[model samples]
Target: MSFLFFTAVGLLAATLGSLVGLGGGIIIVPALIYLGPYFIGKEVSVATAVGTSLAVLIFTAFSSTWSFHKQRKVDFRSGWLYFLTCGPGAMLGSFLTQFVDATTFQLAFGIFMLIMALLLIFKGYLKPVNVRWAIQRTYTDDHGAVHTYGYGALPALAIGLVVGIISGLFGVGGGSLFVPAMMLLFRYPPHVATATSMFVIFLSSIMGTVTHVALGEVDVWMVLGLAPSALVGGWIGARIASSLSSGKLLWVLRITFFLVAVRMIWEGLG
Candidate 1:
């Protein structure tokens, strides 16, 4: 019963995560820590939850990146560029997790999610981060529409560094920060940004997972329960994302994020 329930959680997490290049750990980590005791009669530490989530994200990112690759939406060159700095940052952040306890993790995650929700709410009102640097890139969608986008190399690397640290620290896959920055600051088309984000996440998750494994934090049983659904959900999410505007979904996510954020903060305060 627990395995089945976990499978369902994985499906939901991966579907939502992949659809937006989120890599599913945002959902998985919290669910395992907060809901696990109630539903599965087991409680996991933050480190175990994060480690397990990152392991499962490996499959989700691969599946989404493959789907996006087939659509020709992924920008491999840029993904690699971002990963250059992101890799080491992942290692750095993973080491810092040992200092965090469950309540602290809950409080911090809640604050982060609150910020994410606010970003979604005010994204339209926000201006692009002004920068003088540019590295030109182009993509052609399935319908033959050409789109050009680029981010300053230094700025992107810096952002990727922050994102990698966040990914390892929270096991969130970093799309919460990546996608909006790409679309807003870099002027990437929605599909292109999401596809490319997944590619970067795949690399980042691997780095984080390795660190977690070295720490003996991973839960093999949780990974086994979540991985199959992750594979299915990632592909499905990419397909859906490729076909439609994510406006509605983002709105839903904003509410969900806000609710989760409040839950975490309140519980942490208690």
Candidate 2:
């Protein structure tokens, strides 16, 4: 029954996460922290919840990345660039977790989520000045549609570094930040950003998961219970997202972030 319950939650989390390019950590981490107690009749520590969530993300991120790759929506060039910095950042973040207690981690996650929510809500009015750098390139999607975009390499590298660290620290896939940065800062289309984010997340999650496992933070049984469902859910969600308009996708992301923020804040306060 416990396995079934967590599997169901994983399914839902993966579906929503893939649709919005979040990689499902935001949903899975909180669900496990707040709801696991009810199912297990004991409190689950924040580190355990995060570690388990990262483990599950390994499967979901791969599933989502494969789905997007099939549609040729993923921008390999941009994704690789982000992955380079994200990998190191994730490693550092995982190590840093040794210093963070449950209360501190919970509060930090809540505050970070709240800040991200506000950023998403006011993204339109907070646009940075457009600047072109030497990394200009044109990408063609599976549909033969071409997108030309450019961004400062240094700025992108910095963003990737920060995002990777955050992902490792929070056991998230970092899509929430990566997608927005790609769209707002790099001028990538929403669909392209979402696809590329999944790839970047897949890379970051690999390193983060390994680090968490070494730290003995992951719940192996829970990961086994949730992995299969998360894979299926991610595939289904990516397909659905591919059919939706960019505007609709952004709305879904915005709402999810806001709701997650509220929940995290409430839990942190409690």
Candidate 3:
């Protein structure tokens, strides 16, 4: 039963994550905390849940990234540059996660989820910042339309550091923030942003996973249960995303985030 539950959580989270560049950490972390005890017969602490989620993320991000790569959407140059700071930041954040208590973690995560939900609500209305300092880059989409976009090195590094820290601390892969930042601040096309975000996540999660493993914060059994399913779902999701717009999908995710946020907050208060 525990295996099945974990697998389901991984599959669902990875599918949605690949579609939107979210990396499925939001769903995995919360599910591990709220539902894990029911199936595993033991409560999973915030640190353990986060660590486990990050471990599971490796498979999801990898499969999704590879799929996106095959579709010629990933911007590897940008990904490597951002990872320079993001990787170290993830290590720092993962180490820091140990200091947070369950209550604080739940409350903080709930608030974070609510904020992410709100961001999604306003994401479509946001305009690109378009900094002149950007190192201009270009990508030709499947339709033969060339999209020009870029970001300043300093700004990109700064965003990577912050996003990486958030990813390690929350086990969320930072895609919610990454996609928006890319689209709004860097003027990246949605598909490119999402693909590149997954690439960066794949790298950062490696650093995060190492930190968590050193701290003995991960549940190896849980990761084994979740990873295979997550891999399959990630591939499926990326394939779907390559050919589809995600308008309705985003709506469903927003609702899910709202419900999960409220429940997490309520639990923390209790």
Candidate 4:
């Protein structure tokens, strides 16, 4: 029964995550917390549940990233830049959790998820991108040619900081925040932003999981059990996403975010 539940969670999260570029951690973490103890009793601790979820995320992100890469939507340049800050920030955030209680941490995580969901709901109806204080930067790529581009670095930095911290503390991909920040605040195309966000999260999750493992919080068996299901689900989702138009997909995702957000809030409060 526990095996079935874990597998179901992995498949569901991976499918939605691959299409939207989010690992569905908002759903995964809460489900584990509420349902795990019911079946496993003392065997599955809260730390173990969170850690295992992060580990499963590695497979989920990898599968989705492959799909995005095949479509040529992934922006490696932006991904590497974001990773530079998120990696170290995750390591730092992992240590900070020691000072807080478990209930407080979960409550904080739930609230943050709610805020991100609301932002997504509203941002979906806005323009393609917003760049109020854009800055121009020029850099040389691997081919030794210099290219110039404009973006808002200050807001990007701030977004990275907060997302990195939340990701480390909670096992989320931070897409709920990253996608919006890139599209609405930094003025990136929606597809480009989503793809880049996935690439960035792959790095953050690795660092965050490492810290969780070091603290003896990870459940190796649980992660191992979920990987296969998540991979398959991700592949299926990618195929579906490839067939849909951007406008339709955005509307579909908006409705999804609203439904999931309401459920999460209700679950957290109940």
lDDT of 1 by residue, 189-256 (tens): 88888999999999989999899999998999889989999999999999999888878988998899
List lDDT for all candidates, in order. Answer: 0.88, 0.83, 0.93, 0.70
State the lDDT at 206 in candidate 2.
88
Between candidates 2 and 3, the TM-score winner: 3
TM-score of each: 0.96, 0.91, 0.98, 0.82
Candidate 2: clashing pairs of residues? none
Give the runs in model 1 whose Cα sits over 4 Å from its true position.
127-132
RMSD (Cα, Å) of model 4:
4.8
Per TM-score, the best of the predicted structures is 3
RMSD to the hidden true structure, all candidates? 1.4, 2.2, 0.9, 4.8
Q: Across residues 124-209, which tens digit of lDDT does each residue of candidate 4 receive?
A: 57764434455654444335566443455555666777788777777777887788777666666556677777778778888888
Off by over 4 Å in 4: 41-43, 128-150, 245-270
Distance from true location, Cα of 233 in model 3, Å: 1.0
Note the residue pairs that clash in candidate 1.
none
lDDT of 3 by residue, 164-244 (tens): 999999998999999999999989999999999999999999999999999999999999999999999899899989998
RMSD (CA, angstroms), candidate 1: 1.4
Ordered by lDDT, highest first, the candidates read 3, 1, 2, 4
